[model samples]
Target: MAIFRKPGRSGQPKPTPEPTPGQVAEELAELVEELEEPTAGGPADGGPSRQVVEYEAEYRAERGRRRGATLVASIAKLIGAGSRSAAKGAAYGGRAMADQLMQAAPRIPVRNLATLRAQHPTAADADRLAALLITGASRASAALGAGVGAAAMLPVPPAMAVEIAAETLAVAAVEIKLIAELHEVYGVRAQGNVTQRASAYVAAWANRRGIDPTLLVKPAGLAAMALGAEVRQQVRKRLTRSTLRRLPSLIPLMVGAGIGATVNRRDTRKVGRQVRDDLRSRRPAAAAYWSAAAPALPGETAP
Candidate 1:
């Protein structure tokens, strides 16, 4: 009986043609050269293969900037405007603090679903990614106000108080990024451009809850959010709470710094986890949209 190979749809696998002596040496030399060359990712199935660049470096740089700004702002927050009316101290302080947040908000690099899925291919991985951000930001936030309170008490100028405010703003930005990215991870894309989306995120921060998608849209398609009386009241209340929470960071010396950092880290994790739980319940809808646009979430259940 003679052995034979079957012809599959693509035909029989090609039988290796024995190489000539010269061809063998050429192939061997090419193989040596290939092995010696620096290795890098080649095209896979015609798609460009690239790894997600972890943002740790950028995060560090931004944290350093925040720490410096916090020091400067600390003085301003305490002394208030030198030439302004004494009656204006409270109002001016509030306005200046708000201004810090306004500046920091846009600087937050809230990765969208595409970037997230590229970096974190699974739900579990995404969770770790969020956790990493929270932890890193918490450390930075803790560092921002460290010893500044004690520094304020010294013969130094009024800038130290504002540093506390700056630390709070920086921490808020970090948490806001975590919140917004969590929304993206869960498949919910907030309406409008970056600013509008950020406003919605700020609302979530104000409320400490996940956004209601229906409310993300408004009749005035161009308007980001009305911030009507009720919304204003809500934001005011949230800010008040935040201010109260920040009091401890003003503690001077190593003790205050330790407490401030601990509180910030704990609170941030609590907020992140709470928002994640809320989003998880409402994930399927957004997951469907994202699944169509990107990869599926690991272990995502059917809608």
Candidate 2:
């Protein structure tokens, strides 16, 4: 017992000391100081600071405005192109109809009736009377179609779709009636006689336009012709005198195409606006929720 073990060598480990309460308090104070330091460009909490949020809001608003402007401009250009096409189509259709009428007019005996009235008094009186009736009916039908087509081509709002449809139908009716009346007045009373004449007329017009004659004989073809005539007339009325005089020969076709193009454009824009509004109205609430949940301070938990 009196012989104590020799002390450990210098390589032995030393005893550890416990930390004091004062040291613990000092460490806590250092941590608090670090937490209290202001963030570089944000609030102390992790949430976006007021200034940062405001700036972001402004940026987003500006970006939205630019995008909106671009979208509107694109729509306008498309609408303009459509309007031009419709006008042109109508004009061409009218010209075709007119050409057909002019060619057919010579075949009728009325051309000689005018001269006979001053010379032979009663030369081919029955034929002259029949021809007059036929010519009158044809002219009336052509005029009616031209007027309605023109009205449809005007830049009315989309709300007038019903009116436009009515006008288009009216024009087609006039055209069909005119053909029937011409046959009746000319004493072409055979079964399917009017239909045959109509087919021949359509074929002649198609040949002039370089389209399929079969297309011109279809019901759709007649409708198209009437609509086209209307469109052409409208374009002619709208153009400046200088342009009208310069392009007198091509006016009908140009106007019809322009009207069709215009209608397409206007309708497209109307649909686009509706879609934009719907999307804007349907924005998710999640955006607002996330924007509201930002942390108030860098070291604080999100509220």
Instruction: Work out the TM-score per prediction.
Output: 0.61, 0.21
On the 0 to 100 scale, the lDDT of residue 100 in model 1 is 47
Candidate 2 segments exceeding 4 Å error: 1-127, 142-154, 159-164, 185-187, 192-303
Strongest candidate by TM-score: 1
* Top-scoring candidate (lDDT): 1
Tens-digit lDDT string for candidate 1 (1-303)? 013655567887544333332332232222222222222333563533444122444354344434433333433333342445234533434445554454445455666766655544543454655554445444444444443443444432344344555455556666777788788767765777666676677678767888766755553431336334454456556655665676776555446655665676677778888888777777445435565545545686332
C-alpha lDDT of all candidate models, in order: 0.54, 0.32
What tens digits encode model 2's per-residue C-alpha lDDT throughout 151-183?
A: 333443332232223222222222223233222
Off by over 4 Å in 1: 1-96, 99-107, 120-126, 147-157, 217-226, 286-303
Q: Candidate 1 — what's its lDDT?
A: 0.54
- Superposed Cα deviation of residue 299, candidate 2 (Å): 99
